[model samples]
Target chain A: MKEFKYVITDNEGIHARPAGELVKLAKTFASEVKVAKDGKEADCKKIFALMGLGVKKDQEVCFKVTGEDEDAACEALEQFMRENL
Target chain B: MKTYSGKSVYGGIAIGRIHVYKKNESMVRREKIDNPDAEMERYERAKAEAVAQLKGLYDKALKEVGEVNAAIFEIHQMMLEDDDYNESVENIVRTQHVNAEYAVASTGDNFAKIFAEMEDEYMRERAADVKDISERLLAVLGGGSAGAVQSQEPVIIAADDLAPSETVQLDKDKVLAFVTVHGSTNSHTAILAKTMGIPALIGTDVELEEIDGKFGIVDGLEGKFYVEPDEELLAQMREKQQAELAQKEMLQSLKGKENVTLDGRKVMLYANIGNVKDLPKVMQNDAGGIGLFRSEFLYLESDHFPTEEEQFQVYKTVAETMAGKRAIIRTLDIGADKKCDYFGLEAEENPALGYRGIRICLTRTDVFKTQLRALFRASAFGKLAIMYPMIISVDEIRRIQEIVAEVKAELTENGTPFGEPEQGIMIETPAAVMVSGELAKEVDFFSIGTNDLTQYTLAIDRQNPRLDEFYDPHHPAVLRMIAMVVENAHRENTWVGICGELGADTELTEEFLKMGVDELSVSPNYILPVRKRIRETNLEA
Candidate 1:
């Protein structure tokens, strides 16, 4: 299992575009990815679930990846958040 | 020639053949079947075809109305694939040992009820969308096309009534006007025609088929439709149509200019729209953003009510399309001038003043909460503001705040997306004006609805043409109210806007500027001329 935490930078929060991009990138690897904010967790693979988390600007959200491609998933998702989110 | 009258919802002249529109009624009949597996296959095929149909509408709507309106079809597509929606259909077919039609009928009923039971006026309307999709699938299963109005050419759409989805799917070029056998002046189709600047008449008793395929002259201003009018009447209608077209062309030219005064003062000029489909026209007119999104149309559009998710999509789409421009959504202001059958409101002698706007919403907390939730969810997308209509006292505003807080807490607990949007109120009541200083402290801004303010203050029925003389929009008392509201709003460090018909009056442009009005939200046609007048006037003078 791999875990990492990142704070939301954009003022609009984890909006549809960023959440959709993150989901698309997470789906590339054979891993179970979950995003958690303020003790509530959301599956990273589902766009609506990720959006439902409502991770706003300046709030820190954690990502947990489990399975064979956990390492790859963690690295790509981090990059995705940094570049897109 | 024959002439029939109803209500004049939109004022214009339309000359065309009658195109009687018949919508696809869901023929979902229960039948016992031995092959549950085979029924599932049938359901799957119908669902696939439904998705394809939606895809086509999405693409076409995208091209014409832009993405905000098109996103609704996407939401419909999502609803089809929803776990609850699909699972219910599957389980019903698998367990009941019934045909696909029976299972779909029951499942649609179950699904639609979830929305219909919801409290929000805007959200409950989603039940119709569910029913719409279900009916389309049923149409596919029954070997017929969904919403394929076989219009030979451009003609007036005559129907009992039109659903919101049906109105959205209409080919604007092919439909000249909307003439309905039964519909309220505040019906969804009537509101559409008004926003589209198309001629429309509702509640006409004339049987359209009697004069079907024959020419008709629709006098929207007078609320009359003349079937097969003589050459003299036709000539008059033609001349009026040409002049209207010329005026439309003239307005189209002002789509790019900034609303700047000659003296270098700039004010945000915006338009009040009835629904999301009206956004394209608002964009074309180059209005900053929607000043008023009258969400009552959502409630009026559906046979039942809408759901929160459905309302969220609409509000979200409008906010996103505005792209950081202000989208002030007024909560459901039904009951007064608007007649909604579902509300079961007792008819009153003075319906306009009896019960409406914030009064109904406040009493119906569930409906109010749903609207607040959808609005808050949409606030995550772009600049969104909420305005309460017909607020007279500080207590109503306070009660609204409590409800807003409750909705916010609920959203926060669910980890739902929301943003703190600017809140405002429509100062339409004379009592609000009398106590402007006290009321201004409760809101972020104030929007003066001068029409209602004038009506209520003067005690004149706006609907009666006989009271036109007494319907003084420019009376000193009304002007005093505007100035007082503006002063009070400014003192509280909030802005004031005029969204009433008076806001568009060129004669009052300088007067409003002098009154310290922050924004002028008016009809789309008046934006340019108002801007031109503002440019010519010097506030100092």
Candidate 2:
């Protein structure tokens, strides 16, 4: 299992556009990915689930990936966070 | 003429026959299905059909309204394929043995409830999206087309409410106006209507069935709908409609034209916006720049004081969006009539005259510095100018400059990059006008805020309706003060502008130009009309 954390810097947080983009990115990976904010966890593949987390600006969210491609997924997600979020 | 009143969403006149839009609202019935596999297959097929339809709409909207407005369709497509949403529908189909339409409808309600209960206003609005997609799925499953206008000619559409999908499907050239019995100002219908520049009214009491095919006049500017007008009223409205269309055509022609007088006296015409969302209107109206970007909305919209980073993000966005065009952002103008409980302000008998504008900022140096830090950081992106409001003297300008210098030094020490934004002051108070020459030497420019200037000079409480007769914005004292500010600002090579209501008054446009005023900033809608007035003015005459 590989995991990383990122604080949302986007003013609107994970809104419709970013949440849709995140789901698209997650689907491209073979690894089973999940995002957790506070104690609630949501499957990263689900756009509605990701948006339901309501991770606002300055809020920290954790992404956990588990599979043969876990390392690659973790690295890619972290980069996505830093670049886009 | 019989009349109905409603809240106006957009201002214009529409004289046309009414088209009563009735949505084919087929009720989804929950039915036991013996073949669960067959039912799930139906759901899958319907979902695909929904997606294809959404894709087509996305393509059409992209070509017509550009990407940003069309993005909702793209998002809707993604939402239709959302795992949680699909799972809920499929689960209902398998567990309860319900039909596909019933499953989809139930799931949509459940998900919409979640979004409706969200804390964020933007997220709450997503409830409508969930409902919209589900309706599309239901429509497809029922083997029916989504509710759309069948009218071949231009007509005012009257409906209970319009979904975004239904709204986008309508032929734009055929839509003269929209009147709804139910809808808020922020609804998708209202937004699309505004974007299409179609006059709209919501929360109207008119019965659609009764008014169907009736010749009606929608006076959006007056928020009134006149049904079955008399001959005299019809003739009057006909003349008014012609004038409206002519004025619209004239404004359209003024696009990309210079705000120059017949005698070649050039002036900068800009718009006053309260939020970043107003940028599109500013660009559409062809305003040279944003003269007054009210920064108080950030503070007002928040439960607590907005952090430096939050403030920085907004300022940066405005700067970047404006590109090289000057965006003069007025620093926190809270307190007084506009009170935020988060600011911990005490109620005063005379709140208008109490601690406000520069008063609050100067005393709360911590808040002031935080804002200045954000402003300077954002300035690196594009042309940004900072303006202080309700200044009364040179001492205030000097103190503000000292604080600004401290903020700059702090940024430098922290290895933060920033640009040197032009600093200006609002010459509003009588004291500010009296000492304009001395104060102008301290700032880059002077924006005469005529509203407050008139109230102060005349000693009339503008908020009081009793003083409405005495509250004359066109009072000579206010005009002279503006003229004096212009003269004083020019002496120190400082440009001056008017950012108040008087700025949009076409009667004063020529007089302001004659005063050698460098800029006039009005609301975005008035930009073209003011530009037209400026073009006609013969300054030499």
Candidate 3:
């Protein structure tokens, strides 16, 4: 398993559009990706889960990946934060 | 010849054969299929074709409008792929031995009926989406063309109501006017029409089929549409259209010029914006700043209260758009009138008179503080001013100021990057007007919210149909209160702006200029005309 903590940078937080993008990205990897904030976890693949997280800009959260491609998932998610977050 | 009258939300005349677009009703037809294997194959083919057609529609929408708006089609795409819809259609095709078209149509009709019965207006509207998807599926199964309306040069597009996506597909050059049976000022279609500068008449009960292709003149500014205009009236309308065009050209010429009076006094002309979507329009008008950025839109649409960082991003976008220009953000002013079920604010017997605006903010310090902190953080990007709405007394002003100071101190302690934005009060309440001098001394500036000022000063419920006649902003008492507030703010050497509908009133522009209002924040459509009015006036006298 691999994990990384990061802050939400998008102005709208994890709104429907950004959440959809995140879900699409998660589906591409073999790892089971999940996001947690304020001690609550949400499946990274479900758009509703990300939206329900109510993550706002500058709010910090952690992403965890566990599976065959955990390393790849972590690397891709980190790059996503660096570019589009 | 028949005639009917209704509120003309947009203005223009049309002459043509009435092209009545009847609302599509779901149709259910059944046929016997001899082979279950062949029926299953038909269902699979139908689903594939429906998905492809949906993608095609989405592609067209994306190309014409943009991704953000095109995203609405994703819902329809999801409905097409829903397992329940697929299973229901397959069951009908296999058990009843029906053709693919008939099976798909039956399933769609049932689902659409269910959705139409939903209480939520947003969900009810999804019935149309279901019908649209089903129509595409049936069309594919029947080997017919996809049921997409081609962009045509229609002189006047008449309908019961137009979806935002459909409005976007309209050809601006050919579409001289639009007539609809229902729509409101806030509808996305209306907003789009306004942006496109097209003449439209909405909420008219006139049978659209009767006047679809008729020559008439529409006066959007006056909310009047003349069908089959007489020659004399057509001539007059032609002249008016020419004058309006010339005025638009003149305003375009004055785009980069500062809004200065004939006597050389400068008055800032700013845009009143509701969301970041309006930022482009504000910039297009060459507005000096955002006079009133209603932050309620950010909170109203969200399922929960927006976090400080989320608020900061929206505020930052506005600040960056304005660059060095000021963006005055009013905190969430939701109350009985603009109710949010999430906030648990009950409907009041008298909403306008009840707990709202600054009162809500005062009682809900956590909400107010989060917004204040975000505003401070965004201030680093550009000029930002925080304005409190519905401020009724000096006490409220002092209290909010204290809270702002506390937030600033906390941010400093946490080493969060932020700067203190200039704080101000909206002179809306009668009490606020009476205490303007004192409040002005405490705050950086004053903005007269004439809508609420008129409502409270006259003790009339503006939203009540019975009291609408008495809710006039032109009432002498309302004018007197505004004058008092403006005078007091000036006496304190603090800038005062008029940001309500009164700012856009051409009849009162000279009077406001005479009263020495430092700024006029209005809708983008009125900016040029107001600027022209100021230029023609002798303010020094």
Candidate 4:
């Protein structure tokens, strides 16, 4: 499993636009991706599940990936979080 | 006559018969289905229809509103395609043996509840999106037409609150105006009204039953809705509407005409804009140039200080849009009544006389440098000018020049191409006017901000309603300062312009021309009227 953590910097925590974008990015990878905050896990590919996490500003969340494309998914998601979330 | 007041989205007069819009009735009742397979198939078909409808609305919104507002439709399409939501409907239809409409409605309720219960306020608002998309599906399943306006003639649309999709479905030609009991200035209805160039009122507390089909007038300027107005009121409003239309036609004739006096003395008539959204109005009014582009919106709108690239893109857009017409952008004028939380500005007893404008910029060199870098880089795109506000001394100008020199030197080191934009300062202070000769020699031009000049000279707080009677712009003291500044700027071979509320005061147009004010920059709406006034005046007379 490939895992990494990121803190959301956007004033609006995991807003519809960026959350939708994150789901699109996650769907591109064959890896089974999940986002977890405070021990609760959500499927990264699902917009509603990811948004349900309610990861607010300055709150750290962990993304875990398992599959052939796990390395690429981790890199891409980390980059996306920094740029958008 | 009964009158109701609401917030005006666009200013003008709209008088027409009222047409209270009502949403489609979609009361889904659970029906027993013998074949669950057929019901699932029906649910799938309705979902497809809903998606197609959303796509069509997306395209329509894209054309009517810009991409930002149109994006909501695209998001709705994605939400419709959500696997969990569709599975829930399919499960309910297959297991419970219910009709497609009931299954879809129940699924919508469950998902909307999930979003509504979310901890984040923004996510909670997404509940409405869920409801909106589900409602679309329900409408398709029930074989009912979505929010339709049934009217033979153009009539004012009064509603409780219109969804984005409903607002887009409205026939522009058949809709005279919009008045809603619940909505905000940023609502889709308001934005659509603005794009359509029709007067709209929001939050008007009026019963639809009483006003439907009634002859009513929407005075957007006064934010008043008059139902069954008396003959005297109707006559007054009709005359006012006629005069407004006549004035608009007359102003349209002034387009492409020079801002010149009968005696052949010419002056530059420009527009003051807050952002690029006002660019259309600026062009429509035939402004010679953009005299004052307030840059405060960049900082005020953002949660953090806008990065250099962000500021650069905005400035570049204004430059490119103006197409060589002079665009004078004032550097960040924060503090005072406009406060940004990220700036960490302390609450002052008197913010007006406290840390604000150029004072904040001079103190915070890092923030100032980032903005200067962006402004200088954007200058290469068009005839851009930079102006500093809240100046009272020659030393401050010199300090700013040194910083500009440093910025230009750094840009050269980095090999970034930037044009040398004309630098100017606002002469809004009495002290600046007193020492105008020295100040004029330091800058390329002078733009007198008469509103601040009047307030400062009269020692009256412009924001204080109690001082409205005492606050006077026509004080001889203020005029004398302007005249002195003009004379000094002329001696230094520097051009001068008036860019404030007083510039648009038609009564003072000739007086300003007589004082040799080379330019007048007012709001876009007043450009043509001021131009007409300037054309009629014979300075020699």
Interface RMSD of each: 8.8, 2.2, 7.0, 3.1
Q: For residues B1-541, could you state the per-residue lDDT of candidate 1 as single tens digits?
A: 8888878767778888888777556456678888888888888988998888888877876554456545667666655655566777888888888788777777777767765775544345556666777777777889887666677688987877765557766778888888887665534445545555677888887786687788888888788999889999889889988897787666656657777666667787888889776775676567887788899988898766676755776787788888788999999999855867877888888888788899999998998899899899889889999999999899999999999999999988976768889999999999998888888888898898988898888888888999887666789988988998888888898889999999999999988888889899987667766766776788765
Query: Compared with the real two-chain complex, what DockQ does model 1 have?
Result: 0.04
| Candidate 4 residue-wise lDDT, B281-318, digit = tens | 67657899999999999999899999876787678768
* Accuracy of chain B in candidate 1 (TM-score): 0.59
Q: Is candidate 2 or candidate 4 better by lDDT?
A: 2
Choose 1 or 4, whichever is better by lDDT.
4
lDDT of 1 by residue, A1-85 (tens): 9999998765456754556557667778889999999999987876545655667767999999999999988988886675335
The lDDT leader among the candidates is 2
Top-DockQ candidate index: 2
Off by over 4 Å in 3: A1-4, A7-85, B1-244, B468-472
Q: After superposition, how far is residue B357 of candidate 4 from its true place, in Å?
A: 5.1
TM-score, structure 1 vs. true: 0.55
Error of 2 at B112 (Å): 5.5
**Tens-digit lDDT track for model 3 on B119-146?**
5454455566566677767666666554
lDDT of 4 at B397: 94
Candidate 3 DockQ vs. native:
0.11
Candidate 2, residue B159: the lDDT equals 90
By the TM-score metric, which is better: model 2 or model 3? 2
| DockQ preference between candidates 3 and 4, better one | 4
